[model samples]
Target: MKGRLVALVGPEQVELHEYDLPEIPPGAALLKVRRANVCGSDLHIWHFLSVAFRDIVMGHEFVAEVAELGEGLTTDSAGQPLKVGDRVAAVYYHTCLKCAACGRGDFSMCSNAVASMGAPPTSPPHFTGAFATHYFLSPGQFFYKVPDEVSDAAVAGANCGLAQMMFSLDKVGVRRGTNVVIQGAGGLGLYAAAVANRSGANVIVVEREPVRIAAARLFGAHHIVDMSELTTVEERTQRILDLTKGIGADAIIEVTGRSEAFAEAIEYARVGASIASVGNLNVGEKFELKFAPAWITRKQLRIVGVLRYDPWYLRDAIQFLADNGDRFPFDALTDRVFTMDEVIEALELSESRIVSRAAIIPV
Candidate 1:
């Protein structure tokens, strides 16, 4: 059998390639791509802005159906019965339990997290990215069967964006009655709002885009700080304070992918509060720090930089969708869809922000 994949050959360039599928190794599986989303990190990789990700597969967030199961594979990581054709979502990265970080129980920080994903598409078992028609699940990779109720549109992002937000919020202690401020109303921010709202926290989203502002409310934001109206750093800070009853946010989440948003998150955080820095992946001369070290020390803030989440969180994300999929418009998050041939268009639209979320159907 043959599978197709999208390969990044250079900055802002991609090519579609096809190769014979390799035999599924023991404890591994092969999945046929169903739905994939162009996540923010995809944009970064597309632009060659992400370190260690150049000339590789171009996607990570997706849901797939089991096309073939390797020998000795019978159940998912959660012990659920698995079979060919079962819908599943796998952690895009590897979690080598032998790694130092995994030995310390920090699976998310595994030293070889990208061992498989970092492989170039030209390698055997060439279907490594979600943008492709198939994905090869390496041995010991964590995957969960998707509930029958969750649409592919709703569950495609479970692996990356939604799962990461759930983990990030948990890391920062977002809970009932907490004033949680979300920076940016993009996919990550919207997911954060929905998670915080379901936890009974006061979800406050900060954004300038009208479409995203409306989407934020639908995703359960209790209040929104309109950047268009606030117009200044001081003004936005006062608004955040007002929304938090003069205490500032008990938890702040930064997902704007802008350096200024990181500095702005400090202003929105209350004393002793925690901030989850999930965006702003870039580093170097362009993304210089805009905030002062004194503020973090004086306020005693907890700033956590979250990358890909713990593998099991993908299971929790699927469960979250099963429990609350009807409560929020998860299907609507992807405003546009493109076919395998239109993958470039999908990337461009997502990069331009013309489509908040773009889905790729690679069948």
Candidate 2:
């Protein structure tokens, strides 16, 4: 069978190419890709900031339908209970069950963990990524069942962006009446704001883009600050403090990854505030801690780094979206949809900030 896949051939080139499907192995299931969402990490791979195995298929966030099942994988009979024709989202990574981190439910930190795509396969094979027409699934990795009410786009977003945000929210203890400052008004930023709002927090969104600032308000931002009009970081920080009634924000979620934004987050953080850094750390960016000594001693602030989420969070995220779908208006976040043939153009548009969340319909 022929499958269409996005390939990162070099630093400046990403193309959709046709390739032969690999044979299904025992204990694995074949899935037809339905919808794949373009993510920030995919852009990093396009720019060579994150390395991709040469000529490898290049998607990690997607939902698929099971087309075939290999021997030893009986439908609802084997230890793995997925049936053919089931709509599911791939877990994309696996860790050694016996590892210390795995025991603590920290698969991403496991010494023996594997990414489903990109990395070369390891013994007993772990980390299978989903960015192609079809993917192979292994036992012990999670494959979630999508509800009939949820659309393909919702599933795709829940699998990555929403899931990551939910995990970060849990990490930072977002709760009723919590004050949150979200840096950047892009896809992830907007989603973070929506999630924070659903968690009953008053959200303040700081963005440089005017268009995104307007968009942020629609996405549940109680306060919007366009940094372009502000002359100094203190001015911006003051705006956040004013919105929070001089306490500053209880938590700041930095999604821009710019050094200046990181500094601004620290400046605006409340005493005992938590800062969750979820953005990419680009090259040549240095965050200088000029007020660290005073701020650290006075505030007792906590700074946390968020990688991808735990597999279990996917279910929680999906449920949150389902319950709060009406309030969130997640459909508005999706700015464009493209077929597999237009993957490169969709990616370029996303990188240029022309759209919010671009969905790739593989079918």
Candidate 3:
């Protein structure tokens, strides 16, 4: 059977290509995408800023249903029974167990992480990304079935933003009474806010956009540092200090995708504090850093740059939504929905910030 996929032809350009689906190999599966989200990383890839993803399939945040299970495939990564037509969320990246990183049990840092995600659409299977009619799951890929109580809108982001936030927060030791500051109020920031809040941390979000500021509050931010009012880094640092009772933040999360935000994170962090650098994926002179390395040595800060989470985190993200979906506005995160034909419009609107988040439903 034929399947269609959106392929990146150039910077800010995409084209729909149709090709016959390849046979599902043993221990693999094929899925029909039900809903896909346009995340901040999607924007990075759309602009050709990602060196690994140019001329490749265009999406990674999505939820799909099993269209066909290959021979010998009987259960999910968690040992749950799997069946055809079950809703599921798959980890977007690959983890080759034979790789050096995986050999040391650092699955998240697997050397071949983008093996499938960065493949060109002209290749066999031709369904590497979620912006497509079908997605091919190769052998060894980790996937988990979605719970019935969670809506597609709530679970679609579980694979990307939510899982990463959950992992990043856990990585930085965000626990009860920890003063945590999150920069930006995009999907990743919002998800970080919610996760930090649920962890019993004092959540403070730094955002400038009105809509996102309100979203930060909804997602359980105890305080919003309005960039409109406090326009300077020093002023914002004072506000953070004031909010933290002059101790500064115990943990800071940078999710603004702006290089300046990373520099500011150091200013907001207390001595011995940890910063989770989740954004700012681009690397070039344009995204250069001007901060001094002395600051890290003097303050003794822990900075972690996370790209993808361990595959098992997706399972935890699903369970998190199933347990707390009602406490936060997970469904409202997607402000706009578009069909396959409107993929370009979806990308444009998301890029222009006309929509906080966009969803694509394959026709």
Residues 236-269 of candidate 3: C-alpha lDDT, one tens digit per residue: 9999999999999999989988888999999999
Local distance difference test, each candidate? 0.91, 0.74, 0.93
TM-score of 1: 0.98
lDDT of residue 96 for candidate 2 = 59
Off by over 4 Å in 2: 15-19, 52-55, 70-81, 112-114, 120-129
Clashes of 2: 6
Question: Which model is ahead, 1 or 3, in terms of lDDT?
Answer: 3
- The clash numbers for all candidates, in the given order, read 0, 6, 0
Q: What is the TM-score of each predicted model, taking all chains together?
A: 0.98, 0.88, 0.97
TM-score of model 2 relative to the true fold?
0.88
The reply for model 3, stretches above 4 Å from the true place, is 285-291
Tell me the tens digit of each residue's lDDT in model 1 across 99-121. Answer: 89999989899999988888988
